[model samples]
Target: MKLRIFHQTVYRYDRPARNLVQSLRLTPSVSEGQRTHDWQIDVQGGIRGPGFRDGAGDWIEGWTVRGPTEEVTVTVTGRIETRDTAGVLRGHRELINPLAYLRDTPATKPDQALRDLALTAKDAADPLGLAHRLSAVVSDAIAYMPGQTGFHTTAAEALEKGEGVCQDHAHALIALARLHDLPARYASGYLHTTADGDAHEAAHAWAEINVPGLGWVGFDPANRCCPDERYVRLGSGLDASDAAPIRGIAAGHGIETMDVAVSVEEVERFQTQSQSQTQS
Candidate 1:
């Protein structure tokens, strides 16, 4: 299946003065089951700088603005063709190694509750079944509500409140998986809206677990389903902080506002022969 995606992020400040720097991880990756085509990034109110591959193999672009800037907008547009191998991403092409997915991050330190949950979940011989059960548990346990926690909120806190957004869901799952020595990482991406409803408000996140033979499989505890063709795989890390789509700093401070809009749509597939015949 082929998909076209457009993501726009805009930030406006009440007052503008001095310097700003931002790290962007907006590019989609091509793996064994997916192919990328015609991907581009555009920035308004800032100059384009060099982009390097990070430790997670994500394309990283650094942008800096000096002196008197009120707003910044970053837009990324791309087309991707993906095939579903039944949720099995073959080989170790991903930047985040499964073994090191649980190497310890400040935000994802699991406590006794999380560890106990992992032990309970891992008792299943089928990892996919275990993941499904865990996803259901999270979805049923945590109430989907905003303003409950911020980016700095930990898994323990989210568990305590029993409510959070996608980040909190992904983090809790990651912490639980790590406790059982199952290599797991946090995935940040967009989920295509179904015909049943309108689009989601912002970027989405899920957790990826590395099964022994099946490789990396995604478990979206927030949505309670494995990532299918509708999900676009972006950057990943041990937790949300590392895989956040946008991270930057501004010298001036009052209160800053951020808005993110993403659109992912399924593209119609046309026969290659028809195009060839048209050319002829």
Candidate 2:
């Protein structure tokens, strides 16, 4: 599938920001299922710095927007060709070991409840099967309610509430996966959901578990399925906050408000078909 994506994030502050520095993991790395065509991130009134890929296999770029500034806008536009690899991340290179993800983060630390829930996912079956079982366990426990939780909500809190958005699901899944000693990390990306509704939509999140032989396989319990062609995998880390697409600090802030708008859509069906044929 061929898709076009547009994402804009704007920040407003009560007081002017003295200075700002942002690290962006906005570009998707090449894997078996997807390849970026042309992508650009434009930071209004910002100067670009050297960018490099981190040990986790994500491209990290630095940008500085000098302030005395009240607002900052970051605009991203891109085109990518994606294939359905059943959520398996293939042909991706990274320096970090899978066991590195075993460490717990504040947001994904499993509580007793999560530990007990992890026991339910255990099986005498294969490790891959057990992972899928855990995914189902999380899916059955949490219902998708967008406004039910906030960004700071932890996996245990979201599970206790029994409701949260995709980020919550990813966090909860990571917690459960780690409870069983499985190496799991949080993945941030864009999903082509609006093509189904004919409207613009938001970004997407999921969990990737490193199975014995499977390497990294993504599972989105919120959707009750793994990522497919509709999904675009970006950076990954120990948890949501670690894998955030954009992470930064603004100096001299009274109160900062952020607004994000994302649009993802498949190119025309004919265009998709033509692209596929050319590649084949």
Candidate 3:
């Protein structure tokens, strides 16, 4: 399937910001299962800097804007072609060893609750089977409830509360995987939902585990399934904060407010203004 995405993030400051710099991980991953047709990121009046693919196979780009202004908008528009890879990440280049992801971050740290959850899967026969079982266990333990958690909420906290959004699920799953001595990391991206989707927000997140035979396999505990054609893999990190689509800081001391809007839809028939060939 081919899909188009439009994502816009706006920051409004109470006072003029002297300077702003942002690191963006907004490009989609390319492999046998997915490919980008066209993509662009526009930071209003900001100078686009150098960009490179990191050891995790994520494209990182830099942007800077010197401003005596109160508002900045980052707009992203793109088209991509994707297929169902059954959540298996294949043929993607990366320099980081799988074991590196075993390390835990504050957002994904396991508590007694998470450790107990991991124990449920300890007796599974195979690594891949155990991974799926853990995913379902997390989904069941934590209902998909929006507005139930904040950015700083840890995986253990979410599990205790028994509800959270996709971010919470991803974090909890990461914690659980690590408790089992499996390498796992948080993944950030976009998802084009089907009719029965349980999406937390327009922007989406999930977790990835490295199996002995598989490099990185993605699992969405919130939706109880592996990533498929509806999913777009952007990047991965220890947790949501590390894998954020946009991370930035303003030089001035003005308070910052943010608003984000995102959209993803399947691309069908549409006559181009230039009337050119349009296959994704």
Which regions of candidate 2 are displaced past 4 Å? 194-201, 269-280
List per-prediction Cα lDDT, in the order shown: 0.77, 0.90, 0.90
Query: What is the TM-score of each predicted model, taking all chains together?
Result: 0.86, 0.93, 0.94
Q: Encode model 2's per-residue lDDT on 43-136: one tens digit a residue.
A: 9989999999899888999999988898999999999999999888999989999999999999999899999999997773987898899999
* Higher-scoring candidate on lDDT, 1 or 3: 3
lDDT of 1 by residue, 186-248 (tens): 888877776675434437898888887787888887777787777777778889988888888
Worst 10 residues of 2 by lDDT: 193-202
Best by TM-score: 3
Ranking, TM-score, top scorer first: 3, 2, 1
Go through the candidates in order and give the clash count of each.
Answer: 0, 0, 0
TM-score, model 3 to reference: 0.94
| Error in Å for residue 208 of model 1 | 0.9
